[model samples]
Every structure is written in structure tokens, then in C-alpha cells.
Target: MRFRPLRSTPTSSPTLAMVAEPPADMRAVVIDRTGPPEVLHEASSPVPRPVMTELLVRVVAAGINPIDAKTRSGKGLSQAIAGYPAVLGFDFSGVVVQSPYESHPFPAGTEVFGMLPFPRTGGSYAEYAVVPTLSVARKPTSLSHVEAAGVPLAALTAWGLVVETAHAHEGQRMLIHAGSGGVGHFAVQLANYFGAHVTATGSARNASWLRELGATTVIDYTSTRFEDVVADVDVVIDLVGNVHSDTGTRSLGVIRPGGLYIVVPTHSFPGYAEAAAEAGVRTTGYRVVPDGSALATVGRLLDSGAIQVFVDRVFDLAEAADAHALLEEGHTRGKIVLRVSDD
Candidate 1:
């Protein structure tokens, strides 16, 4: 509910002269109260300005994730931290229009993509987003805005679990749930790239696609119980938390002694640790944070085709409610993105 001026005093960048003044008000998908996807509606709000160490970006595309919907429904982290009349989006790819601090690495007009601060106000579901400089990295040239928008949050979750937290390496057996979903697709690819033998769970229809994303084995969760067939796994990345089934607790049985069960859900049921202890395995809940350096590494990998981003569908910004509805169906093959503006 605070507003800052869109245009600050000109910085040293020569491109500043070419940067146009932002509009007084811009279209944003805002949630005034918690409910279903219909609660998210397009509204007009003041164009947010960059403050110290922040970059004001003109968003070209934004990525939709389950958290956005959970937040809108007042069921997740957003319910605790988000103020009413808040914009609900985290991942974005855009061009920087203004940088307010001298130490900011990106100049005016830099094409950048990254996740905003999680469990906080990102306001990325808008025409313009003001983000901290350290949270963004240069966009990958090989990807379009929509493709780049899909990478940050999902890729970061995968990277944080496999590379940073679990330290999965060659010859390790890693199991990823929801392998065809946004984060799962990225986790499968990144784990394989890091030399781990990856197993992923999804429907039979997604088996070949999951394999192409580096899933060595794709378990059809609809027909098979993962714990029954999969055992002695070094790491289990549980994106499908303990919501419908005992996924978190059952995953403990598959992990080998001293192996890790990284829960990726924002919230979990009680006694996960006790179950892990009973199985002589370790358990930790993982949350992705904003890291420009890590995102830069991801960008390099994306540009080199070492990792690929899969976009299942693209919706216009006005259709943001529809996007959330589709994501809630919980069976998207990859990521769904909202095209905010043209490049």
C-alpha cells in the first residue's frame, strides 16, 4: 500500500536517456480477499518505482506456480505475510527500465529474469515490477521471454534441493515426484546433469517426456505405489507433499540409511522427522531463496542447452485467473506462463 516514484534522478547509464517514464497506473492481477482462482482479477495500480538497490522492470512475461494459487486462497505462506489488495506472482522475465542504486549491476534496458522474494510481496503479476538487484540475473539469450520466465522459481527449487542441500552426485540414486510438473522437470534435468541416476513419478503418458528430461525411470504414480518398487534411494525430492496421501512418510521407506528426504512443499504434516528417524534417514524441508548468482549459473546452463525449460501453455495477462485454475488441476506437464507484454 506504499508507492514510490517510477522515475528517479538519472543514473550514469547512457541508456537512461532512452528509458521512457513509466505510466502512472498499470494493469495488475490483484487479490483483495482469499478464495478461488476467480479471486484473482485484473486491476489498475500505481506503477511501482525502484528504491535503493532495486531495479524497476517492465515485465514481458510471468510464470504461474501452485504457490500463487495457494496464496490467493489464504492457505499457504502468502496468507501469513501478504497484505490484502496484493499482486500474486513471483517469477518474471523483463527489461530493466531504471536502476536506483550505484552498486546495481544491471543498467537500463538489461533483459533480466529471476524469482522475487518468496513469502513476500513480489507484485510480478503486473506490467511493471520493482525487484531487488540481487534477486535478478541477465536473461538467457537462447530463450524467449515466456521460456525464461518459467525457469526461476522451479529451477531454483530443483537447484536448492539437489545441488545445494542434498549435494547429489554421480552414481547416486535420486527420486523426484511429480516429474512432469514445473519444478520436477527441472529437478530431473539438473540431477542428471550433476551425474545422479534419476527416477521420477508421473503418469504413464509422461514417461517418455520425463525420460527426455533425464529421468532414468518414470514410475506411474497412478498405477504404482512408488515406495513398493523404489528402494534404497539416496535422495527423495517430494514435491507432492503429504496432502492427499502419505507421500512424505512413505518416501522415508525408500531412502537408504543416511540418505535425505527433502520435502519441497511449503507446509507439511507433523512427525516427518520421527518417521525419518525410525527409518534411519534424514529429513529436511527445503525452500528456494532469491540468488542472482545461482540464477546466472542456471542461465548459462539454459543457453548452452545443458538444461531446457518446458512451457506447457501460455496465457495472456488478462487470463491470469484461467492460468491459476489450470495450475490447480495439478497435472500440468510443465510450467504455465502468462504473457504480460511484448518484447
Candidate 2:
């Protein structure tokens, strides 16, 4: 993968210097094997110490991603698990408990929210999560812990696709499939923020909500064929997999040549890569990285009400199994979160 030239050099703030460390033996949700969410079990595990550029956070909540359950259910992510007794979770909101680098901006009490790359020991579904300082962002003051927890994976995924992958610009025409799903809603708002002329595909029930998020047009995926009504797009963020393979594959029809089609779950989709090539379109899948700086920016945006977080459900850590079941249903709007500790 190519790296973008650094837009700005990293800056240090007082918030970066104040994070604290956790004591050993904290309560955390863990999995011994991959199968069902039932595989995730509560365990008293050693609280990890942050290394250079890492911060230990006292987790208040963890965001649930569809991929999280996919990994649990032995799908695309099963091999990503190294062994049993694995901790599973990525997005988290918490207070900074410790930092190895004194130049840190998040002081011991500073509340922060962000995503961790998967397969790490510092799982977010615990009393504490260890995050690379780069991936951690200060939580937006206007949002509650549960709300902040929901932002990282889905929101960042949207940001990565709309802003980074597709390079969506103001007045550009864009289409977001599954506009009511966790990542789709954020794509609508973020793309709109960039001045894109946005169209979103979702159920008729979410049309008004999509409009509120800045979708200029909303297609009821159930009642209308998107290809039949949509055309001439600069970008398409495909969130649905084979379930809408025809729509996803034919999405190329809408893109102007030199346009982009980004599929979140197409890694396992049959002929996805080949289809993109045949259509003369550029397409790629992505895995989210820890970007503390981006999170901080998102926090500021949240505080200003430029973006809104949608929570479909919140479950206690003990109910993580139930949470995964809900996610597996595949129709949830916005995000599902788990309350770990407290605010």
C-alpha cells in the first residue's frame, strides 16, 4: 500500500502528556476459540503496559463492528485470531490511564475514543484498552461514553472510503449503498461535508433520516433498482457483500470513467476484483488503522455538531454474545456498542 505524504507534522499538546497506566488483572471479555459470540467469555487478564507511543486507557465502552462478529463466527477473520483466549474488540471510549511517552497529550483523566487494529491484546471490551497513541483520539465532550464508543470503526471506515479512497470532493456525485447501516450513515454525512452530491440506497423507512444526513437522493433498495434510477457517479461505497452482489457489481454503470468503487466486504466476494478490472474502474478493500490525529479532528467536529453518532443498541459487557447476535441480523442502523466500565 502506498502512504500519503504526511499532511502535517505531529504536534504535542498537554492532553498528550497526561495519560496513566493500568494495574494488572483487569476484567475483560475474551474468547477461547472462534465460533459464535458465545465463544467470548469474561476473564481476569493481565492489564497490558503501553510501550513507546502507546497509552493505557480505562475503557468505559467498546464499539461492536459487524466484522467483530464475523471474526467470532469463523468467517473472513478466523485466521486473524492466533489462538484461544483471544480478546476481541477494536473501537473504544475511555479515560487515559497511562502513557509511556511523556510527550503524550491525553493526561491520566482525559477521556478519549478511537480504534485499535484488530488481533491485539488490548481489546476494547474490557476495563482497560491499550492503544497506540497514534490511534487514540480525545473523546468529544458533547458525546456520552456509549456514543463515543460507536464512532471509531464505522465512522473511520466511512472517512477512509469517502475522503481517502474515493477522494470525494465538493459537488462530486457519490452513491453510498446501505446508507442506514453502521458505516453508511457516516459516509452520507462525511461525503456531504465534502460537498458531494450524495445518493444513498436503503429501505424506504430510512429515507427521511438519510435526507437529514445530506443524501440528495435516497433509493429504497427494497422497492427500486438503484441502477435503474442512478447514473453518472464519481464514487460508490459498497457496504453490502454478495447479498447485493448484482447491485454492487453493476454499480460500475454509474461511475464516470476514472471514478472509484470501494467495497468494504468484497474481500471474499466472488469476482469482485475481476469485475472492477473489467469495468475499467478502480476498486479496493481496506483495513482501518489507528489514527489518533483523525479521531481528535472527528471529536472537534462532533463537538460542533457537524456529525452525529447513531446507536442502535447498547449492551453490558456480559451480554456481548447477545450483542453479536443482533449484529448478525444485518439490518442494524448505525452502531451497536458495549458498556464496559462507566463514565
Best by lDDT: 1
The TM-score measured for candidate 1 stands at 0.93
Q: What is the lDDT of residue 44 in candidate 1?
A: 92
Model 2: which ten-residue window has the lowest total lDDT? Answer: 13-22
lDDT for predicted candidate 1 compared with the true structure? 0.88
Measured with C-alpha atoms, the lDDT of residue 159 in candidate 1 is 88
| Weakest lDDT window of 10 consecutive positions for candidate 1 | 10-19
| lDDT (Cα, tens digit) per residue for candidate 2, span 290-323 | 6777777778878999989999999999899999
Displacement of residue 20 (Cα, Å) in model 2 is: 7.5
List, residue by residue over 1-343, the lDDT tens digit for candidate 1. Answer: 9998698676565544226788899998888888999988889988986666778899999999888888788787664664668888899999988887434578788899997764455568999998888889999999999999999999988889889997989999999988899999999999999999999999998999999989889999999999888899999999987878888888988898999988887666477778788889988988788898999999999999999999999999999999999999888988999999988
Q: Which candidate is the best by TM-score?
A: 1
